[model samples]
Target: IPILMGLFAAGGTIYGMAEESLPFYTLLVPVMMAARFDPVVAAATVLLGAGIGTLGSTINPFATVIAANAAGIPFTDGILLRLAILAIGWLICVAYVMRYARKVRADQSQSIVYDQYESNKKHFLGDHDETQTLAFTTTRKVILGIFAAAFAVMIYGVSSLGWWMAEISAVFLGAAIIIGLIARMSEEEITTSFIDGARDLLGVALIIGIARGIVVIMDKGMITDTILNSAEGMVTGLSSFVFINVMYWLEVLLSFLVPSSSGLAVLTMPIMAPLADFANVGRELVVTAYQSASGVVNLVTPTSGVVMGGLAIARVPYVKWIKWVAPLLGILTIMIMVMLSVGVML
Candidate 1:
């Protein structure tokens, strides 16, 4: 289940769910407790999995699409590079989580959140059955098939038809209805389930909204351009390679203030894209840097509602979460820096 959840969270990263970790965390926390593993393991599986996933987003509308469009480049221009980054990220995240899971499973005291895990077990694990495996029924198999088909349709629609988020969301809505029908849920049950799901995810929505508020404040203050202008002067006269690396780190810093990928694209890409031309760097490289850097920072930035809110749900203190995730984050950053250097050469 941890492995499956990690894969699922990785997919969520592709969709750019930096501030939306609660739903996955909710599903994982209980299972981890029931398995007698640490809650930190559950949190790490979802949080870091999604974090690394976002860093590797190839076709994410929020990150790649907006940044590409802002740079006046075709979104498909950086596909191969982004896919390579994603593949590397996915491998690292899976290995890290698996290694940590083994440690905690063998001895729960090694977990940073061991005390909290013990206290919370009663609340989260009372009804769970660690020994019982789910029996797959005909209806369950049909539901799984529909779920997989929905993803195929989404990929085809986005890659071939250029469908946007609205259309992708519609596909999910249609699939949800079909799944409900196949499960033999009554109309009332469907409605109730939908509400319950939404209610459970209310914190995620609130966090995203609050995070956006920071961007709103910066825009109104008229300091956003000042920061951009300042950044431009600092990068002037650097070699293309150095310039792109600086831009990557710049995006990492700016992402702290503006957690929204689309917002950052709209704010920085216009300025950074034109500047890239003067530095003898490709606009595609600029976009890649923005998406990659911002995605990495999202893992730990306080401005990101996703990180803070996810930690809140997992009962993880901000300091402890940092201590637990920092080593892996550093490794991921070094790997990305190498990839960006390669991208500059390309």
Candidate 2:
């Protein structure tokens, strides 16, 4: 109530992030324990943030709700389909990423001198800290506690309340009450942190603006119609498995532009509904394809506002994330498509 009225926007191509406090900060904060420049930690951070964000994004307006409605399904009814799609996407992503990360380590052969997770575990068991020892004062503990509690509450708020306004609002309010007393912060100083924090998000805000542009442009151009039309033509006389493959490939390519689950479904439904009926493919199966492609494509797309937003928030450059994540995404996409083919045949 004190700040923004709500957290998520209905159709933002980019800035429309969800309100989960736990997952959002969890992905980035692991960095504090990593070596200042460790690539493993960086990769892990990218994976966690983008993965959780997408999973949660299922309920997100653009990613799931709006498109579901447009797809001729009730908004809440698509939740199961979205979950199935997200699971398949994550499975492929994690399997390939683990290998890609190993290759990065194998190729570089650098010592895991500052593995953040390992370091944190050690610290919990009485390991000696070098540089950060002096920095981990009572104030830091209080601030961390505040952040943690705020995150916990906000996570609940997201699953229940379904808006970013409450979560973000909670953060500022918690920070003032907790960090303020611990640091004996003046009202001026606490207010300053809020300003600085919001300012830090300018880059993410910009990316959101661009994502909106892409959705609007693609939608205005009627791209989805062309995609579904092509799918219909390709599978006109194909067998069950081939038909599934045709639609799968179509989605893999379309996902590059229509990363939002809802957007893709909206673009797909008018065409897919008739095609599914014609082919005797169940509506649920067609939904499976939509969900699967939606998850896998965004993981690698440079246009993905969520992925880009994570990088921006972490102060990581876009090219760096893309460079490391591309190979992983490629392998994952292939695996997901192949698996979905098997499922469709069954």
Candidate 3:
């Protein structure tokens, strides 16, 4: 009643939480605080005001619960760890954003840099709007039909041949042919698209490919038996926590092998939890590494279902996607590490 009465008193100045409230809040909070805070402080306060929703979205309870319990930690423990991590990681992320936002603005200021250079400028047929240049040709329809049929056949073929990846290649090959037909593509056009697709996937696919390496990197830190063993001959060995870093790195690397984040947790966390405790480390730490390592690298990897599906849907060449997101993947990886290291998280 008090809140409503106050809002009613303000009338037009007050607004309800509705579909478009987010941008409104972002723009309004600073204005409301104009009397009390300096401009910088007011803007920051407004930005921070929206923090809870962002945190909640990023730190999903379902993922936390799944990771925590599977790793033999309490669910509450997961929440606590997530909150801490969120604070630290997001602080670093935000600082990075603030730092880079200027660079982005600067880059956009000279937006025609690529076009300004003469040699590197590309005018390939399928580069931008292939849909306009390449009509649906007879060959394209046939190839598409063959590609569609391959889906059913590939499933059966996998059961028969015991090669899961054969299906993917078959589909890609069939699609290539279909695309060629529809575009009335010459052999060169067919080859060009295939090459283009492969080219685009370079970095993005590799990022997915390297998830396992990152996980393994953490797992193999100084705290591992191997480190302890090396230390046995030396002075004192490394801290046990260093071993946690090793495990985290190892998990990142192994993520390439597992591919699916939740699936990897199911397979690894059960084993990892006991291993961490046996090694005298915290299970929550391992879970943190596992989640972050899987997440950051997963965003860039081409082999992922989301990635491949997005490419297929967008008609983006794999190489192009790689070129587009490779650096972002690096930035995100650094962010994950920064989040994990600063005691911001569990």
Local distance difference test, each candidate: 0.78, 0.55, 0.45
Error of 1 at 184 (Å): 14
Candidate 1 has a TM-score of 0.77
lDDT of 2 by residue, 43-114 (tens): 344444345345334566555555455556655654544455445545544554455445544543332433
How far residue 68's Cα lies from its native spot in candidate 1, in Å, is 1.2
Instruction: Write the residue-wise lDDT of candidate 3 on 1-346 in tens digits.
Output: 1222222112211111111111222233233222221222222222222221222123333244566778767745544555554455445434533443344244533222233222211311213332355568776677657655655564445434544454557655775676677667799888887787577556444554454454455456622335334422331233555655666667666565555555667766776666666556667766777766665444345445444433332233556545544564566556555655543233
Candidate with more favorable, higher TM-score: 1 or 3: 1
lDDT ranking of the models: 1, 2, 3
User: TM-score for all predictions?
Assistant: 0.77, 0.69, 0.42
Ranking by TM-score: 1, 2, 3
lDDT of 3: 0.45
What is the TM-score (0 to 1) of candidate 2?
0.69
Error of 3 at 250 (Å): 1.2
Among the numbered candidates, top TM-score falls to 1
What is the Å distance of residue 19 in model 3 from its true position? 22
Worst ten in a row by lDDT for model 2:
1-10
Q: How close is each model in CA RMSD to the real structure? A: 4.4, 7.9, 15.5
TM-score of 3: 0.42
